[model samples]
Target: MTESAFRCLACGDGHSVAVHKAVADYFLPTGIRVDYVRCAACGMVQQYPVPTDVGPFYAAYPVHARKSLLQEVTRRILLSPVYYDVASLRRDQLLLDYGCGDGWFLDRAKRRVSAAYGYEPTAMQASRVAERVGVQVFHDVAALRAPLAGRVDVITMHFVLEHLTDLSGTFALLADLLKPGGTLHAVIPNLDNVEYRGFGSRWHGFDAPRHICFPNADQLKPVLDPLGLRLASDRFVPFPNTLAASLSILFTGRYRLLPFLAFLPLAIVWARLYPRGTRALTFVKHEN
Candidate 1:
C-alpha cells in the first residue's frame, strides 16, 4: 500500500496523530495490520487508505445469512431503543432500512409500519432477503431513491454508517431522501467508549477495514447541519456483542458467543451505567 497524506474525513483538516496501530481483523485471517489516527480538528478517528476493495472481505460475513436464536435475541436487545423510537414516531408511515442485512430488521419493522423497504448492496443477499421477508429490497441507492425520495417517513442505518467511505455524500443523499420532519436514525460504534480506551487496538469497535470511520457527535453535526438535518437526540447505546467481539480477539482471534454469554450479566450493568460502546443518534429533517 502506498503512503498518502493523512486527511481527516470528518473535518477536512489535514493534521492528525497516530492513535492506534497494528490493529488486526478479528473476523478474517488476512494478516493485515491497520493504523488508526485521531484528527486534531474534530477528534474523529479513521483508518487510512480506506479499504476500497471490500467485497472479498465481506464474502464470508456472518450476518449475510440466517442467525441463531441467541444471535436474534441479542440483536433485538441491542436495537430495542431504536425500534421503540421508530415505532413511536413512524407509526403507519413508510420506513426504509439501509444496509438491511438479511432483512431481519426490515422484516420485523414491516409489521409495525405501513410499508417497509430495504436496501442492501450485495445482490445475492438482497435477493434472498427480499424473497424471504416479502419486502422490497433494493440493490443500490438509485433504486431506493427513485421511488421513495422525499417521501420516506423514517430511514435507519443501524450499525451501517461507519462502514461507508463517502460520509458527506451519503448524508447529503439521506437528506434528500427524507421528507420534511422525517427522522434519520443511526447506530454507530463510539470511538470514545470505555471499551475502546480499555481494549485499544483489540477494541471490537475498531473492526478494522470494515469500519472505515469512527465518528462522534462533533464529527457528524457539521456534515448534517448544512443539509437541514438537525441532531435531535444523541445517546450512548451499548451492545454486548462488542464485548463478545473483544474477547474473541483476545482469546481465539475470531468471533465467538461463549464469552458474550458469560459476560451477559456484567454487560447489562455496564450498558445501563456506561452505555458508551455504541451510540444512537436521531437526525430530523426540518420542515421548510
Candidate 2:
C-alpha cells in the first residue's frame, strides 16, 4: 500500500503522514473513505484528499434549526462569558460573526453592540438569517466588508475555522477586517480531547470531509502569533454536540439523539475532568 502525503493547513509544514484510516463523514454518511493525518512538525490533524464538492452535504445542514429553550439556556450559561468578552473589548463598535450560520450568535450579539453583522457561505441561510434578524447576513467577504464601512471592532469564528480550507489566507483576511486593538474569538475542535483518544477515527470532531483541519493550541498558536494576533486567553469548552456525535458513531454509525441523552451526564463529567477536546481562544490584533 502506498502511504499518502499531505501538508498541514495550519502550519504549512510537510511530512504530515496518515495516522488514522477510513474515517467516514459523520454527517453525510456517503460511505466515502478518507485518511486523517497528523503533521509531525506542528501536530495539526487534517483529512487527506479534501472533498471537492461539499455543497450537497451542507444544503441539508441542521444548524438552521432554532434551539430549544433548555438548549439556549445551557449555551448561555456555558458561553455567555465568550460574548461578554466581545462586548468588553470596546463599546459601540460592530461585531461580526464569521460563518454565522442562521445568525444565532449575531442575534444575541445585536443586544450587546450597536450593530451586529454576520457572514455565512450558504446563500439561502444567509438570506433567511438577514430576514429573521433584520441585520445584514452577507454571503461573501466583499458583501460583508462593504456594509461595515470600516474595520470591525470584534469578530468571532465559533466552530467555523475547522471547516475552512485556506488557513493562512483566511487568517489574513480576518486580520485585515479587524480594527487596531480589536479582538478575534474562535472555538475549534481540540485534537487532544478525550473523545479523540477514546474513539480514534470515530471521534465526533473528525467530522471527516467537512472538518478540513484540526489544530490543538500548540498547533494553532504558531500560525496566528506571527500575524500580530496575540493570544489573550485559551480555555477548553464543553460541547454536548460532540458527545452526541460520538455516541452516534459508536452505536448506529450516524448522528442521532438517543446517545446524546444517554451520555449527557457522562459528557458533562468528562468535560469537568478533561476539558481538552474543544477550546475557546481569544486573540487581540496588535495596535499600530
Best by TM-score: 1
The 10-residue segment with the lowest total lDDT in model 1: 81-90
Question: TM-score for each prediction?
Answer: 0.91, 0.88
Write one digit per residue (lDDT tens) for candidate 1, span 1-288: 543477777777787877877777776666677777888888888887666677865767877879889788877877676443545644669988888987878887887788888888878888999999999998887777678889888998988998887888888888888999998988898877678888877877788757888887778877888889998888876576676677767776665667656766676777677777888888899964
Per-residue lDDT for 204-271 in model 2, tens only?
87777678888765677766777778888888766656766687778887777677667767776766
lDDT of each: 0.79, 0.75
Which runs in model 1 stand beyond 4 Å of their true positions? 1-4, 82-86, 89-91
Q: Write down the lDDT that model 2 would get.
A: 0.75
Question: Quick one: how many clashes does candidate 1 have?
Answer: 0
| Among all candidates shown, the one with the greatest lDDT | 1
Q: After superposition, how far is residue 17 of candidate 1 from its true place, in Å?
A: 1.8
